[model samples]
Target chain A: MGKVAREVVEKAGINVDELVKKLVRAAGAEFTTYYYYTILRANAIGFDGEGIKEIIEDMRIEDRNHFEALVPRIYELGGELHRDIKDFCKDAACPDAYLPSNPRDVKALLQVLIEAERCAIRVYADICALTAGKDPRTYELSAAIMNEEIEHEAWCSEFLGEGPSGHFRRGAPGESPYVSRFLVVPKPGV
Target chain B: MERRWVTIADSSELAADGVKGFSVGDKRIVVVRYRGRYYAFDAACPHMAGPLDEGTIVEGRLECPWHHYLYDLESGENYYPKNVYPDDLKHTVAPLRKYPIRETEGKLWVALEDAKA
Candidate 1:
């Protein structure tokens, strides 16, 4: 726990403990979504259009990146992940992105992806809003994360044929254009 | 026996199939408006304490947002895995924890189990 770091936020009239709970939930959602997206991506092989797998994979790794980026901040605020993994996932801010009952249907799969991204957008947006003036570090980090989530939603929605994403592909999968600067240790796996 | 009737949010606030969760003393619970009627249940899923309020409504059953486990609203029965996995004997899934709720004058009240006894 960053004793002085948390004190400043508390003195700013922000409920640091409540904010920490929200942060942990948001991080849990990202990690659990990463898990669910793996299953969704595997089924994307021949189901949807050409870039289906790529879109899912990109969001999957970036979601993990979001988790990684949020951890240091969580500890900084004096919050820690639950000792049990089950508790952590159960308390995630966003719902788990479970594969649809019928995974073969491409449309259902796309809907799952779209909804998950949309939920992520809400999560980060809430964090950004909460910390906007009181905590510069958390606010900036959440805003950066939300920027990526917005694009992810657009990509998934576009894939679902809802509309054009207005985005070409990222330089590579999970490039995390807005968030990579926060990841001191690069490469989600490395 | 004593019962604690706690007033929940106004009826107009919750839409159809909508869920709202709150703390009644030390216990967390969710008040759901389903099919134009109000029903209350323990906010946490029996399996993993998944926020049932975050769950999706499906055919009178609520799907736990964490694992997609389904629970019947009124009966508080495990719906999904029970429907899929037959009595092969490893029935770890439990029924939804339920609370009794009543409505009067545009407001809803829930009877919580862990009230001061």
Candidate 2:
């Protein structure tokens, strides 16, 4: 069982065994999303330049660390890791909602990163809210994850240099003409 | 900065589920009517500059069609699909830039240029 989960169980006056199992499942979901984004970012680097490649690599390492961080908690909670990462990928919530059609396109990659960061921000925030005051240790860990996610989003946005409009324009070529057409309204007096 | 009040639309021009786009000099703005109130924001999305007027308003939040990023109309805060941050931090500083808005004579006016600080 993970040391932190054990502590939470011991301190929260709850059944240690049951809480550990719940945490294991929760961690499994988080690990799945982390793994999926890591793969997506890794693929994105090849289509982009060294700068993006470096960013992707750094993000991958961070995600892996998150997964590793959860393992101890899983074990301490007497839960097992979901062996197949693919299973988790199939139903990921945010970062996994959409994959870039071509990973080599820097713009596409940036768009994906922006979306992923946004998702991470909300998901981590929700997690922090869930654990707040209820489980101090978990709250601390989640809060940390939330901060990094925000940084990742800001980095991606700065790289894109354009907000939502720029993102859609860059990705427009990859999408069906119909989809692109639906994204804009005619400018007044244009 | 020059603040010229460009005529956006007649107050009654926007119906429920309706969004209109306008330009004041080089800036783009969107006027939306949802939940019986008129609201305005930067015409583009903060993430990738998605045209905000082209998106849909539901439950007081705007959902970008490009990636489904939802932003609260009132506070211009992204609601769903937020980024995750590390611990040891007190708060996340990421938020969309909000424009000042006023309703005069039933018409909504939004400052397209940065306000004087």
Candidate 3:
């Protein structure tokens, strides 16, 4: 708990406490999405000959990265993730990305993926709006997370032939191009 | 404990469409005017607590602005999922509890309990 770090945000007229609650909710959404995406990834295999599999894996891992990046900031703002995992998950800011009852339907899977990304985009957009021009650190972090979420949406939307994502697949899986800077602790394979 | 009537919003703050949010204590309440009458309800939407204070009264159903979840304006009974899915899908949502509200002299007041739900 850095006293001055929290002090500065409050002094800027931001409701430091409410901001912390939003961060915790955002983190919970990321953590649960990581868990759910793993199941979706398994279902993705051999679907359209595995092109979707690789993308699902990237999104799954990046969602985990988002969870890792959000925690330190929550603590910096004097907030903590709920002590009970169930409590944390129940309060997640987005609906659970449940595998469709009909997982074999590729469009059903894509719809789930796209909607989850859309919800994440809205969640971070609100955070960014709240912190913009006030809390620089939180603002940067949320803006970065929002970038990745938007790309995730584009990728899923393009896969569904909604349109071109205007982007290509990751150079390496789950590179998290926008959010990587905030991920200070490197994972083993990175 | 008896609840006291608290002034929530000026009648003029509402738009012609009659959708607006006002803060009363720590709670965010949405005040809507439907059919030449006003109504108030807590704004937390199902699942994400979103669609907060940004909903529309469409044909007497309050529609969640983001996901389009619908509820009856007066009774607060959810009218979605149950309408869209199969008869056996058995989708149910927690009813949105309505706050007891009154309009007088161009002002809206709600009787919120000391410890509200």
Candidate 4:
């Protein structure tokens, strides 16, 4: 742990340890969501499933990107991910987005996806609200991830034909316009 | 230990349809007022410990802000899953713990040990 890095947030009157716990849990949610989405993406098939499958794939990779982005900040704040993989899943901040019993029912599948994204939006919004102005880096990172989550919700809502979400689909697979910069991995084709 | 009365908040802090959070001896308790009655329950969500102080009371249920898991303010039972969730998931969402609360002398008092299931 960098003494100076840790003290900055502590001196700001924030409980660094609590904040780190929140970050770690948020990261755990992203990591687990990525895994569940993989199952959803695979089961999303056939005629009706084709369209939503693309969206699911996009969200899957972006959630993975979010996990990749959050880990470094967790360490920077003097926290570490659980060594046990099961513990990581158990520590997820949001409930798992289990695939519906009838994966063939596209509507049910979309509902599960939309609810997961909504939970993610609330999670990041709380973190953003807590760390705003006091911790710039975490705040900025959360805001970026929240942007994608909001878009994901919009996409699922639109696919369900709920109404116009006033957003377009991604230009390419894994087009993480907002959170890509925070990723430690180099951008594709860079 | 026997249950003891603990003063939690001034009456004025909780307006009708309002919620307030108070920490009592390491226990975080949230008080909610609805229909001119007050109810108290554990403030941390049974799901993820999301602060229930940040949650909203909807149709007599306290909705956790993190994932929107709701608990009936009166019964402290997980409210929506019975209708919104599948047959299996309804059994998985845990009910919140509730404490006995009363208002007297312009202050709110809660029974520390007698938590309703």
Candidate 5:
């Protein structure tokens, strides 16, 4: 097993540790969507396009639902829901500042959401695989979370009016160049 | 058996500003030249195996087109900033793996050894 998984098994008691990790991973996934929607809502103001505005608003609520579902699991695992925005930001794989330049654009907003959903799918899959048969409760929780993420991905794809694979092409028009410019280089021969 | 050096492409095809993809012996590789030096690595992103050829080159790193995970060309390290967790979770660290690279005669090469072998 990897060092992180082994350390987690040792420090927090196998059952509780797996539960905590799974919950944190689920919450972390929702946090990314929540952060994106919050920015999108702020950018939607003054835009007279009601359809675009409504879509953004609806997604904001869906993300909130995901966050709410994670609260009880966090408590069950003897861990506090990460309430502080700074803490959430600290744990994010991609920083909030790297958000889209034009959040009012539905295309750009959906792009970010799709990316978040993909990451969530991977994280939840890992959690479910690790906890399967070991902690049935966490296994079930991860399975449910994965289903929700799949729905989110589908919704984003539908909103873009393109097949799921279409978003991988050139970035949205007028989107921030910084998002593409910011590269994460790994260490040598890791 | 016959010795072959398929002309993948000219080195100039990959300028300092961008990255290019090539195939050799069924192995896909990405050639990135940064600061006038060429470096090569697996053409897929480590995060989700996204195509690195479709990604952009920034500074000395190749940014994954999928989730924007960056990999340094020379060292193959993730250039993205590290996540700083709370003191309670400081012990958790997730780092990406890197691959070997070589540049000779203006052509880049990467090792393609099967782990099981």
Candidate 6:
């Protein structure tokens, strides 16, 4: 717990407990999404699925980046992840991004991916709205994550034949354009 | 036992699937209008105390937004992960507390006492 850091947020008249709870859930969502996406990415085979593997990999690793970036801020705000792994997973803010019942149906898979990204966008947007002005550090971090989530949604949506994403590939896949600066561990390749 | 009923809102104010949270003294309560009927329960999820008011109601069950643990709106029974949850673990966590609600004269009221089986 950062004594001074906690004190500053408390003095700002924010409910530290509520804020911490939200942060923990957000982190849990990111972590669990990373795990689930890996499965989805691995199963990305066949005609349409193979074509989109690159995008799935990009989103998968970026979600992991988000989880890494969020932990330090959680501890800084005096929040601790549950010692029990079950508890941590059970508290994830978003629903599980379950693989489609028919894995071979590429459209079904895309639907799942698009919905998960949309949920993430909402989660970060809510955090950003709550922390704006009241807690600058969390606000900035959440805003950064929100930007990535938005881009991720666009990429998945474009694949669904919705509309053009207006985005080219990242300089490299899963570059963590907005959140990499906050990660303590060096990314494998930036 | 005597039941104390408190008026929480007018029936017209709640649309189908609408969820509202209220602070009755120190207790947080959530009321949901589902399938033309209203159900009331403790606002916090048993797992992590997630705000139940923010969760979605589907197929007669309300899901906790945090972990997606589900409870039947009427019976307050754990509807998901019961078969998967360890037997001892199931017994350890608290189940949702449901309060009886009545609609009369265009208003909805909740009894302070737990609903009788």
TM-score, per-candidate, Cα-based: 0.67, 0.46, 0.75, 0.84, 0.48, 0.73
Residue lDDT tens for model 6, B1-117: 789899888888877778888778788888899878888999988767888988777567887766666788878887653422334455654678899988999998999865542
- Chain A TM-score for each of the predictions: 0.95, 0.63, 0.97, 0.97, 0.62, 0.96
lDDT tens per residue, model 2, A86-158: 6444333342423445546677667766666665666556556555666665566666656656666776787
- Alpha-carbon DockQ of candidate 6: 0.20
TM-score, A chain, model 2: 0.63
Cα displacement (angstroms), candidate 6, residue A78, comes to 1.5
Model 5 alpha-carbon miss at residue A94, Å: 6.1
Q: Where in model 1 is the C-alpha error above 4 Å?
A: A47-50, A187-190, B1-117
* Window of ten residues with lowest summed lDDT in model 5 chain B: B81-90
**Would you list the C-alpha lDDT of every candidate in the order shown?**
0.80, 0.57, 0.80, 0.85, 0.55, 0.82
Task: Kindly report the docking quality category of candidate 6.
Answer: incorrect
**What is the Cα-based lDDT of residue B53 in candidate 1?**
80
- Encode model 1's per-residue lDDT on B8-85: one tens digit a residue: 777787888898787767878777888887878888888778788876676787766555567888788886545533
Model 3 chain B is weakest, by summed lDDT over 10 consecutive residues, at: B81-90
Backbone clashes in each candidate structure, one number apiece?
Answer: 0, 42, 0, 0, 12, 0
**First chain of model 1: TM-score?**
0.95
- What's the DockQ for every one of the candidates? 0.09, 0.02, 0.15, 0.30, 0.05, 0.20
Give the per-residue lDDT of model 3 (tens digit) for A1-190. Answer: 8799999999999999888878888898899989999988888756472768888888999999999999999998889999999989977766567777766767777877887887788778878988999999999999999999999999999999989999978988889998899997886776
Better of 4 and 5 by TM-score: 4
Better of 2 and 5 by DockQ: 5
- What lDDT is reached at residue A83 by model 6? 100
Q: Write down the lDDT that model 2 would get.
A: 0.57
Clashing pairs in 1: none
**Which tens-of-lDDT digit does each residue in A124-183 have in candidate 5?**
676677677665555666676666566656756766776653333213321212211211
The stretch of ten residues in a row with the least summed lDDT in candidate 1 chain B is B81-90
Candidate 5, CAPRI quality class derived from DockQ:
incorrect
